[model samples]
Every structure is written in structure tokens, then in C-alpha cells.
Target: MDIHHLITKLREKGHKITPQRLAICELVLSSKDHPTADQIYKKLKQKFPTISLATVYQTLHLLKDLGLLLELGFPDCSARFDPNISPHIHIICLKCGKIEDYETENLKEQWAKIVKDIGVEPIIQRLDLYIYCDKCKKNQ
Candidate 1:
């Protein structure tokens, strides 16, 4: 979702509109890196010197509750948030912790078949493929 839509939703929910909150929303929604809350706090703290990590966490959680992003959790690592909530695959680099999105029509078709065969209703669908990125592979 874009900044304007986000702001409107916040307003509808009776949330206060703050510049810091706007910055946090822009920072998270503008990138595809799927940064963790700590990463976002560290980066924004540079711009808004007085910004607190708690603020970043709160904003992120608020957006999450609004269903505007997807949160991916990894073992022994900080959870990464993705603004692109479409059904797709997340390729994570085991070596560098890089996250990339991948989507294929074949996979979508297969998933539909699986659901039809099982005859079970589903709410959330996600697939994460863990692998090393080309740069990380070269380094290794």
C-alpha cells in the first residue's frame, strides 16, 4: 500500500498522524529488502535523531495488524517484514540473510490443485525457499 492509503487507514482507526510515523511507513514500504525492525530503527535513527526503536516496532506492528504487510520469521534471527504481501516464494540466503521474492505460475497452479484435492479451506498461503544468493555463493 502507498503512503496516502496507509495514512487514511490510520486516520480511520483513530491513530494520530505524526511525521515520525510517516517516515517509518515510507521507509518500510519503499524498499524490497524486507528489513527487520532493528534494521529499520538503525536506519531511521540517522534521519530522526530522537526516534526510538519502540516507535519503529509499534508502527510496524500497527501496519501488520492492518494487513498491509507480511512478517517472515526465521530461526535465531530477527523477523523480516515484507510490504509485498502477494502469494510468492521468498528465497533467503543462508550465508548473508538476504531475502528475495520469486513467483511462478506453475507453482500457483500446483497449489490450486493441491487445495482442490484436499478439499480444505485455507486462509494464509506462503512458501519460503532457503538458498544462497549468487554473491554469497561467490564469496563462499
Candidate 2:
């Protein structure tokens, strides 16, 4: 989690990076789990008790708009924020509510072909392929 580089990148995008916003960015980038704004607020509270939930939400949205974060879908509820914006799939555990990243490069061509055949330009949206992981299956 290189805060300096992230700040520089945000500055390059003409986004002002305040210290509060930087703290929020640090929390997101350092996190492995795709956390919601509330989750981020809870963690940030430890160090920055005065930081408001609305601020966290605004920062997350801003970062997502800048293409530096991914807004992941939730089948049951609110969206989750992911720092990794790179093209990849995600698997969510139904029981424990765990989120894991799944990387595959083979799907690019297939997706492109599908878009071509459909004759509609499709923006390759964030892939969320839900499946029971090995641990979840074993528990089941």
C-alpha cells in the first residue's frame, strides 16, 4: 500500500488529496477484504475518530469514479468497495460472507466475441461470479 504513489496518482487526475481523504485511501488500499463504507469507517475510527461516515462514502465514490477502485455488487445488500480496479472476478462466500479474488486471463477473448456477436458494445463490467469456495463447501 503505497500511499505516496496513490496520492500522486490522484493528483495526476486533478483530484485534491486531503489528509482525511488520504487516510481513507490508505485504509482501502491496505485492506484485502472488499469493505463497505461502514466497514471502512469502523477501521478509520480507531485512528481518526472524527472522520464522518459521509466523508468515507464520498471518498470511496470519488476514487471509484477515478477508476482507482471497484464498486462490487452484493446479492443481499449494499455494495462493497475494492481497491483493485484491474480486470478480475470475485467469489463471495454465502455463509461467512468472505470475498476472494479470482484471476483469469482467458476470458477476455470470449467476452469480446460475445460482445461482437451481440452487436452491442459492452463495457467489461466488474465480474462477480459467486460460488462456494473450498472451505465453504467443506463446511457445508
Candidate 3:
């Protein structure tokens, strides 16, 4: 992801893209790994030694509030961050703790049908499918 484009988008959205925020945005947007606030902070701190952990936490919340990031929940205590806002599913590797995003357009249709049949509105805030990935399973 181009950091300049991200900065431009944030500015266009009326978000003040501070230097620290820009760094955080660059880190989160460019990452394929669904990292936590602490993980982001630790990596970012290497480049920007002055940045604080509290700032990282605040930036995470700000990006989430702006709909540029998603908070993924799991049985594990920490929340994970995802940059993709499009409807998708996450497959969590139980052993390695890796989160991979998958897009299945048909799943939405199936969900819609299920909701219609059940006569209930679906609160599809996020979807996470937990499984032991092949590598993890093989290691066992």
C-alpha cells in the first residue's frame, strides 16, 4: 500500500494525518499480517523511537473509528487489526496464531438466505473461522 495514498485518503476524509498517525497508518495498511496494537507499536518504535505505546493504541482506535481498520476478536485475549473493509472471512490458525483473510461472495448470499428464512436480522459485524492450518496440524 502506498503511504502517500493512504495519507491523501485520510486527509480527504477530514482526518488529521499527523506524522505519528501517518506512520501507524502506513504500518497497518501495508501489513498482510493481522497484528495487534502491541505488535504495531513495537515495530513502529524501531523506526520512530519517540513514539509511545499509548499513541499506538489511540491510532488503532482512530483508524477503527474511521472504518479503515477492523478489530478481530478471538478466544485469545488481544484484538487483531485488519485493513480490508470489504466483506470477508478470517481463518485463524489455532497453533501458530496466524489470521488469513478470505473473500467468498457466495457466503454472503447464503447468509442472506439464512437470515430471511429465520426471520431475523443478522448482525454480521465480523466473521472469524478458527482452524489449525496445515503447517500447524503437521507439526503436531
Q: lDDT: which candidate is best?
A: 1
The digit string of per-residue lDDT tens for model 1 on 17-132 reads: 89999999998988799999989999888889999989998999998889887788778867999988767888889999999888788877888888889999776667888898
Residues 1-140 of candidate 3: C-alpha lDDT, one tens digit per residue: 46776677778878887788888988897787899999999998878899998999888887787677888766767788888876678888888889998877797777667668989764445777889999988889
For model 2, how does the per-residue alpha-carbon lDDT over 49-108 read when each residue is reduced to its tens digit? Answer: 789999998999888877778887676778888887656677787777789887766776
lDDT order, best first, reads: 1, 3, 2
What overall lDDT, based on C-alpha atoms, would model 2 receive against the true structure? 0.79
Per-candidate TM vs. native? Answer: 0.88, 0.77, 0.79
Distance from true location, Cα of 13 in model 2, Å:
6.2
Residue 40, candidate 3: Cα error in Å is 1.0
Which prediction has more favorable TM-score, 1 or 2?
A: 1
Off by over 4 Å in 2: 1-5, 8-15, 116-124, 134-140
Minimum summed lDDT over a 10-residue window in model 2 is located at 121-130
Lowest summed-lDDT stretch of 10 residues in model 1?
Answer: 121-130
Winning candidate number (TM-score): 1
